[model samples]
Target chain A: MNMREYRLGVSHGLPVGMGYFSVSFGFGAMAVSQGLKVWEATLISLTNLTSAGQFAGLTVIVAGATILEMILTQLIINSRYALMSLALSQRMGQRIGVFPRILIAFFNTDEIFALAMARHEPLTVPYLLGLGTLPILGWTGGTLCGALAGSVLPVSIRNALGVMLYGMFIAIVVPPAKREREILAAVGLALVCSSLFAWLPVLQKVSAGISIVLCTLVSACICAAVFPVKEEAAV
Target chain B: MNILLYILAMALTTYLIRVLPLTIFRKPIRSRYLRSVLYYVPYTCLTAMTFPAILSSTTSLVSGAAALAVAVFLAYRGKSLIVVALSSSAAVLAAEAVMRLAGLL
Candidate 1:
């Protein structure tokens, strides 16, 4: 175990964990308001570690949907993770063994995946674990606090805090987009596609998860065809 | 409705979606097109999730747009994640405060 790599992973994870704390705080408050016990909300955060999927799952549970419905909802909402996982798997290569892969999979939330991918160096199991540790703690810990507190924070502060994760997303995308025309094109295409999904009457009916997946696929495919990364740079 | 069952099922479904690709696809992808798509996926996915969505994330469109503008500017200038994120949140608060002062919120 390289302590240096582990520490670097932990440092990279800190901001992500903080962002997760704020988002999951909202999730916890919403879960309690919807009648979940504090422990139950915290447990969901700990076990599932997904924002959209858990929120959608909660809706299914509250609606008294069948388990099959629950499964289907999760499958659609979290399907983007499949793509992210595939990309991350390639990024990690075979150095990450089965056991570590399984463990890392549990903490492969969107932010963690982005942070991991941003690293220029080859990934290691210890680093991945360190990257994951605080996020799990923050997510579950925030849920526990939020569920217990039950929306104690004022509306204005909550509203402001809500943008934290999106801000981080922008931070991650902008640097790379600025450096590469293909990436910029892909980001721009995704922006337009997602806007259509959000606003078009017919397309707005599509769920957020599916819409994101569709946007990603469309934008990525177009960019790939137009501007294939140089052979050596693809790695 | 069994809550434990619901949570377990939800967790399992999400876990499987995340875990399968990682464990199954250990080899490097040789296809250039596919690799390029993978290379571009993170940016596209993050951008898709950020926009339009961020515009509606805050208390009002004004505050949300303010946050987006602040985030983009800071990020374009090569700010760190924490700085960009906190600055964006601060922009939201500032925008909301202005709106409130103007009796618009």
Candidate 2:
């Protein structure tokens, strides 16, 4: 990587790391509260980095569900990442190295993807490798601290703190929404689908992960058909 | 032996699911349809997790009801999600207080 890209990567890593801290901490605390050992909780946040999949998997574990259910749940919840990775490959530089791509792909997420894509230059493998590392480190570190201090923290505090991950998510969503007005429709569509899934009895039995997959799929299909960009203003 | 293998397999499969796709699909994929799907994925995923927890927390529905209203207001008004989240949580906690005083869960 060039010196400039390396510097930029490190600088970008800070906000991403700080942003990730609370979300990972919450994950760790939740895992520990759910009866996992600290190391297991730490490992989960480090490895998965996906709140929805891990949470769904944890639920399956608690219920003693079969492996088929476990596999299906994780697959459904994480399927969206494939789409994100696809969007990213377009931005990859010529002759992007395989190892970093392989390693960083494991940690691919909304925030890191946004940061990588925001660059003026091509998103090279080294730059992404450097960028993806610290954010995940902060997350796993947060998980460890939260798990270690799981019980000492008061319930009310935990209740309030649990919402920060949602905040981080909104931060990621709002920027793109501003760039493209079609996003408003997308949000509305997704929300309506979610509400239907939650309220309608026929759909309520669908596992939460499956519900997400179905809702996202249906919402995206509807929004794409109804709210195509005006040809000149792509997001 | 079986349980240990299950855990090991879970870890391996999870890693493979995450990394394997990128290895194959190295070309630039220009599917606006799929990007739209990814954009909405977060909301659906968040709702899937939060909807059940927030709903189950209240019995009488007054507090959770109020909290939902507050959350929607804050989010719509361009207030930060943190602010919206705080106000809604406060609403629920306060609602719980009232319900406790009134002998409800």
Candidate 3:
């Protein structure tokens, strides 16, 4: 746990923290629009540490979905992180015992995962901690700032900011979709299915949590079957 | 009360998903099919979360759709995430301002 290495890791984390600040700002504003108070929204960000899971959970909550629905939605949406954690665990080496591993797991956002995996050597606890610190603060701080702004902003402006969440979603999906045929097909299918869930009478009655789970599973299954990625690229 | 419970359940669920694998899986899972499925999860989830809802999220469907178009285009052109978000939000705000002035909002 060298201090110099820890400092370097934290410095590398600064950009991810900056990016998270803007994205979570949108999340906070959207959460407020959905009726959560500033503190509640920030609390969710602090606890969840996930973008899609938090967003989906907020949707479920706003829709007045039940507790079972909330749990299931988060499980399905965030299960990908389990895979990431598995990949990371294999890389961080065995000196990392149970407690530090658990701590690192909590901090393993997508950006952190990428940065840690890119390292040529096995990761250390302090370095991982250093990487986690700023992003955590940035995420929660962004939520707090945005939620406060949401509460104070005029109605029209708050409504305008609501689109930012969707904008962030686009920023996440578009680059990959544009580059990969399989992803494009899967996303297109998901969009069509989601629209039906929203507009079709019988499907419209389906809970938001159920609809998201259904759409994600169905689309992912279809892509996994039809476009089974080649072995090397699957990783 | 219910929101608090929901957030707690969500945090618990998310934490377990992340920690279980880190604790349990010392070796990478070898199944290609399963890995591919995991790879597709974010794409499907984000896409499902984005659409139809985005259409209704803004002050008007027209403004929302216009902003979405701008977002997709900018992203396809390789814009960074923050840039794409800022530009798309700017597009929506600008479009809404026009719509409001025209008494169309």
| Model number with the top TM-score | 3
Pick the lDDT winner. 3
Per-residue error for A103 in candidate 3, Å, reads 0.5
Tell me the deviation in Å of residue B32 in model 2. Answer: 5.7
> Candidate 3: which stretches are off by over 4 Å?
none
Deviation of model 3 at A154, angstroms: 1.6
Candidate 2, residues A149-205, lDDT tens digits: the string is 775776544543444444434444554455566676676666677778888899878
**Deviation of model 3 at A201, angstroms:** 1.8
For candidate 3, the lDDT comes to 0.87
Candidate 2 chain A: 10-residue stretch with minimal lDDT = A226-235
- Candidate 1 residue pairs that clash: none
Alpha-carbon error at B16 in model 1, in Å? 3.0
Tens-digit lDDT string for candidate 2 (B1-105): 233333344555566665665677766436665555555555555554554345443444576565666665566567753465457657666776777788865
Write the residue-wise lDDT of candidate 3 on A2-54 in tens digits: 89878988998998899889878888988997889888999999998888899
TM-score of each: 0.76, 0.76, 0.96
Per-prediction DockQ:
0.58, 0.31, 0.79
Taking chain B only, the TM-score of every model is 0.80, 0.60, 0.93
Q: Cα RMSD to native, each candidate?
A: 4.4, 4.2, 1.4
